[model samples]
Target: MRDDIVTIEPDEGLRTWGWVSYLLHLVVAVAAVLPGAQVSIALLVVALVIDLVKKGDAANTWQASHFSWRIRSVVWAGVLYLLTSWLWLLFIIPGWIAWGLISIWFLYRIVKGMMRMNAGLSVETA
Candidate 1:
């Protein structure tokens, strides 16, 4: 069961999973909007776990050098955490609902790939 968890970087940063992460998030977001929020909640749990399992310096992954979204990553990570917890509570009760709160921090991820190229440095050095 523990194998279900995958932490590519034991003591590093977010792992690369191509653009699929965004698609997964999109699905989760839609699920949150639906009447039954289970799908979204599960997705959120997985996502939150992914973030938690990852280990590394925040200033790496080539996103840190940029003066742009790198800062946003930290903020977004925090926001995701809160939203996930809120959703966990919501899933516990049927009547309860979680207002969709889009984490603005996500933009940093898409921009992160480019920021890596633009800055020519990973989070550690930049």
Candidate 2:
């Protein structure tokens, strides 16, 4: 039988992948507000792809929390966007409101993850 246990090493600082994911998400969030910028969404897609590719291997590193956090944030954000997307076809105001709320939530996740990472703490898994 294979052991399912995972050990995370103790290492923290700007040298972690967690920190890089945080910065990428932050840029995507901020770039959304910029005019004529579709690049932000592309960046977000790239970040999510990286998260997917690295998450399994991240289990043995201190960066696991960050990977988990980023993945969850992306999944949640996508769900919210999709669920609220129908509102756009009906009422413009409600759609905008939903988008705004999702944006705030996205920012919150990024900020919270970054703060925890900077403080040498792992992000909350739940």
Candidate 3:
């Protein structure tokens, strides 16, 4: 009756940065989906800084857990955005729909990760 091909381990949880990371994810989602707002790299820098500062000198789970897998994911997001920009120019409607779908998918993953982290922490305290 179940369809999940992969099962997540119980011990792993979201990174320590937690809320800050989720907020940064929101920033990234907004920027990616609303790319027409134009050349504003400041916010992206802000997101990156927030990730680093909020994370502090703590062990890096994201960049190291999968050995830069997150880096590659972020890079792939950039690629998708760039490719979609061209598509947007070609045809406005479908382009935005695709962008919205992709953005939502990314946001869902971030939020799900955060929720699992929160759930684990709660159970630990309980």
Reference-based TM-score of each model: 0.35, 0.80, 0.54
- Give me the displacement of residue 86 in model 2, in angstroms: 1.1
What is the model-wide C-alpha lDDT for candidate 1?
Answer: 0.41
lDDT of 3 by residue, 1-126 (tens): 123212233223334444555566666766666756443556555655555554333342232222122233456666777778877888999888877877776666555555655554221112
| Model 1 misplacement above 4 A | 1-15, 18-20, 34-40, 55-59, 63-126
**Candidate 1 per-residue C-alpha lDDT over 84-119 given as tens digits, one digit per residue, 9 for 90 to 100:** 666666574422322333333343353544455334
Say which candidate scores most in lDDT: 2
Ranking by lDDT: 2, 3, 1
True-structure lDDT of candidate 2: 0.74
The C-alpha RMSD in Å for every predicted model, in order, reads 11.1, 4.3, 8.0
**Counted clashes in each candidate structure:** 5, 0, 0
Which candidate number has the best TM-score? 2
Q: Is candidate 2 or candidate 3 better by lDDT?
A: 2
What is the C-alpha lDDT profile of model 2 across 1-126, one tens digit per residue? 114435456454323555566778999876554535555477788788778877776675556777888899989989999999999999999998888889788988899888877765667732
Q: Of the candidates numbered 1 and 2, which has the greater TM-score value?
A: 2
Model 1: number of clashes? Answer: 5
